[model samples]
Target: MWKIYLLAAISFLNGTSEYVIAGILDKIAEANHISVSSAGQLITVFSVAFGAGTPFLIAMFARMDRKKLLVYALTVFSVINILIAIITGYEMLMSARIISALSAGVMQVTVLTLAAVLAAPGKQGGAIATVIMGQSSALVAGVPIGRVVASHYDWNVIFIGIGAVGLLFSVLTLFAIPKTVAEKPVPLREQFKFFMRPRIAAYLLITFLWLGAYSVVFTYISPYFLDIFGMSNHGVTTALFIFGIASAIGAQLGGFSTDKWGAFRTLTGGMLLHAIALLLFPFIGQFAFLFYVLLIFWALAAWSSGSPIQFQLISLAPAAASIVLSLHSALGQLGMAGGAGIGGIAVKNGLLNYLPWIGAFTLAIAVGVTVLDKVYLNEKQFKETQSTLFIK
Candidate 1:
């Protein structure tokens, strides 16, 4: 139990590190004397580093003791965040953000891998959900709290506060986690081989599309509320709070759905719901109540896909769980990077209203993938049946 909590704390630190900037972007831009668009480069750099670093680090460190690697990664993360707190210029800050992202990427994959090893058989989904709750909780509480800190103190203080929390969590993890090793060691070459399987490639493609679509609109949600609904800061904060709460619920629902319905079905349903919500966003802007309700649904659909995808990938690459999970996370981060970049370009080009349309198109692709996945499953089943009959 203590170890589980420690692992979850590691997740909380990663979540805070990932999102604290969203709440404080305005303050950071003002303090650095840069345009908001320029400040957003920080997000882009961090996400790209995170995406690109995950598979490499996991493969390189696959044979190391998990606990020791976690400690080293957490220490690096804490130091980089502290550096972010003190950085004075854009270039330096971006450098710190990338370093922090590398740490975050490794830490997240380690936590998930550790959780699966710790869980009892048949409980992998629940275990993963418990740790992932840290991310959802951060969306619920971390951003709003960071906003308060940025409003009352300096944006630098927000990073400082997160650094302090991370240091404390690292200490807890070091003391609580038992020394552990991978049950089956996988060579780096073997880990990469998993991607050669067409099924695995399909899974990765679906992940990229799903996350790219989700983040595009989600990345600019604050601006959307301000421009479309004329929402004040308080209103935007309230809506975010609601969205976060919905996301937490969605995460749990996703876990349950995966256990009950299997990954493909759960994914298809979730994507369809997400598409509907995105399509409704533009039209719902006139009704504040309806708009907030739709945001909750949107969050639910968007976040609920996570556990199913993670479980599917881990099952597919059972011999190299760590590598597959790391790759999955890296690809997801790439989706975030792509989404934010495209969304930023759209906003800059004065096509902000078309953001939801883009999301709709992405979700449509996801739906198509879902349909293909089902068709593949059905055909596979039929072939197996025919083979069994011929043997008899």
Candidate 2:
């Protein structure tokens, strides 16, 4: 359990950097004498690199001792944050962002894989939940703190503080986590076999689509509030804080429901909740308090999918769990990129309010994929499918 928390601490660091960028984008642009749109490229570089490079990097390093690789990743990740704080110029920041993305990408897969490895029997879902809460918690709490800090002090200070915290957490991880390795060294290319099966591929697509929907709205949430509800900085911060709390709590709900009911039900319920909330977004803000309430439920539904979806993938391909999850992380990041693009297009077309509809449409397809699997894929067939997804 403590190990799980340690992993969450690492996730907190990764997620804070990943998310806080949005909240502090203006400060970054101003200090560097770049356009906010150009500063936004920092996020573009990180997400694209994380999405496109994660699986290959994980597959490339599949043979390494999991524990040592994790430590190295943490060390690099922490150092990179500090470097970004000290490094001058947009080009340098862009380079550091990409490098950090790669390291964080590896850490994302390794921690989830290790969480499953370290969990007590029958408690893997809960363990995953504990680890995921770090990211979700960061999205809620850490980013606001960073936003506040950046507003009052220097943006560099935020990164410096994040780096210092990351270093402290890495030290704790070094002592707390035991050295471990995968069951055996899987051939690097053989990892792609995890995606060979149709059912498994469908699960991965669902991951992509679910995350896509979330990112579409989230990519512009601050602006959305400011524009639609005329929210001020403090108001946006309050809204994010509420959503953040809900998201953290939602991870636990997803884990509990996954363990108790099964991944299928948990995922369906989560998607349904998300779809409902998103569909109402266009009309809900007028209600003031109800809009914030919807935001909470939206966030809960948005994040609650985290554990069950990953748990489902691992369950579907336990032997190649690492590969499956690596791709899951990659595709999830891609979905964020894709969703952000979709949202950008919507905004460009004078249809910003319709972003939720687009998101809901993606969510609908995601839910359909699950139903497609459940109706067409059965117990015996699933076992046979799993067998096909491995390299013997």
RMSD of each: 2.8, 4.3
Q: What is the lDDT of candidate 1?
A: 0.80
lDDT string for model 2 (1-392, tens) is: 88898898888888998988767765787899975456656776788899998777877787888888888888898899999999998899999999999999888778877898999999997887677778767888887888788777889998898778878877887788888886665664676776778778888899999998987777767667767778777777778778888888888788898999989999999999999999998887568888978988898888889888889888878877767877787888888878777776676567767888899999999999889888886565867768988744
lDDT of 2 at 8: 84
TM-score list, all predictions: 0.89, 0.83
Find the 10 residues in a row with the least total lDDT in model 2.
35-44
- Write out the backbone clash pairs for model 1: none
Q: For residues 156-243, what per-residue lDDT tens digits would candidate 1 score against the true structure?
A: 8878777887888778778878788955556667767877876676778788889889878777766677677888777777777788
Clashing residue pairs found in predicted model 2: none
**Model 2 lDDT at residue 232:** 75
lDDT of 1 at 64: 87
